[model samples]
Target: MSRARSDPDRKLRKAKGRTASSARWLERQLNDPYVKQAKADGYRSRAAYKLIELDERFGVLKRASRVVDLGIAPGGWSQVVRKLRPKAAIVGIDLLETEPIEGVTIFQMDFMADEAPAALSQALDGDPDLVLSDMAANTVGHKQTDHLRTMGLVEAAAWFAIETLAPGGAFVAKVLAGGTDADLLGLLKKHFRAVKHAKPPASRKGSSEWYVVAQDFKGRE
Candidate 1:
């Protein structure tokens, strides 16, 4: 395990145009150990550590041969997948443009589009053994609305995984801190042998994000 160095907390001077919120965010980033470790480890964002921790606990990547990455902007999660499973076929989609990563087929489009799932499945050429979603809807500053939108994306991703995953495949997705809603949980329980939720240490203590891991797909019979 990489440890955070004992550096002093960095405080940025209040600039002419920086808002208080932005300044606080900047300071938080400056002081975050995971952020610093991500830079040193050549990962794209601190989020890479969250996936690493989750995988360490769940072994989600160990046996994956083909993978789909949803919400792959900045390409951090896919980068981890590439490094951990060098031979796995990887396909990723995001509304935001992502710089190309070797061994990853990226499509800069909304995952909710009617044709998006087919495109991902076609690119992989077979059912994926692992599906990862780090997607979150753009917050409209309303907590309830934000949660609903994000959960909707999660539900869509779950359906994609259910529809296309190979038997015994795994699905991992980001959810709100209260965890997967009742309907989604019931859906996963119906199709997977195991369903669990985890909040990795790399996630900020103040953040309301959690991850749901569903494995051992029962297949679409």
Candidate 2:
């Protein structure tokens, strides 16, 4: 068994200049099994496991040849894609700078920018077989406002997938606890053959995060 699989729980001592919240977060990271596993497995972030689990359950990566990864900072999801689909052509965009990955084209630009869509489409050079989005708007602490903000990004990602995905393509994106809202859900159902909501095991139990997987794009009719 891997060391990560056998490691015992750990705690961190409080440090100077650390806020209570920061200290708690550090302690949680210290004890998170997924964090240990990510270090052991050479993944940049624990989030890679989330994509792994989702793909295992949904088979999202099986047929993917060209992939678009939105909000690809730290490049964990892209790393997962490259590992699972070594021959896939991947293009990713994010507001934050991301370290280069072996098989991915990274663009450090805001996905909300007008030129972003054209840039990604051009880079892929073909309609993507899979579009993955792990975007969330920065929170302002108000629950309702935060939900709406993140949903806006999710909506944008869904529309991008619908517009640029090949027939039978798949879209997977992160959504909050309530899942996709009514209007967005309706849009996904209209464009895809199947739509489902999932909370992967890698996500924290206290987290509001969930995933919306839409598969079998019906073509632009």
> Best by TM-score, which number?
1
Compared with the true structure, all predictions reach lDDT values of 0.95, 0.94
lDDT (Cα, tens digit) per residue for candidate 1, span 1-221: 58577357567887999999999888888888888888899989999988999999999999999999999999999999999999999999999999999999999999999999999999999999999999999999999999999999999999999999999999999999899999999999999999999999989999999999999999998
Model 1, 220: alpha-carbon shift in Å?
0.8
Candidate 1 stretches greater than 4 Å from native:
6-8
Tens digits of per-residue lDDT, candidate 2, 150-185, equal: 999999999999999999999999999989999999
* Candidate 2 residue runs with Cα over 4 Å from true position: 1-9
| TM value for model 1 | 0.98
Q: After superposition, how far is residue 66 of candidate 1 from its true place, in Å?
A: 0.4
Measured by C-alpha RMSD in angstroms, how accurate is candidate 1?
0.9
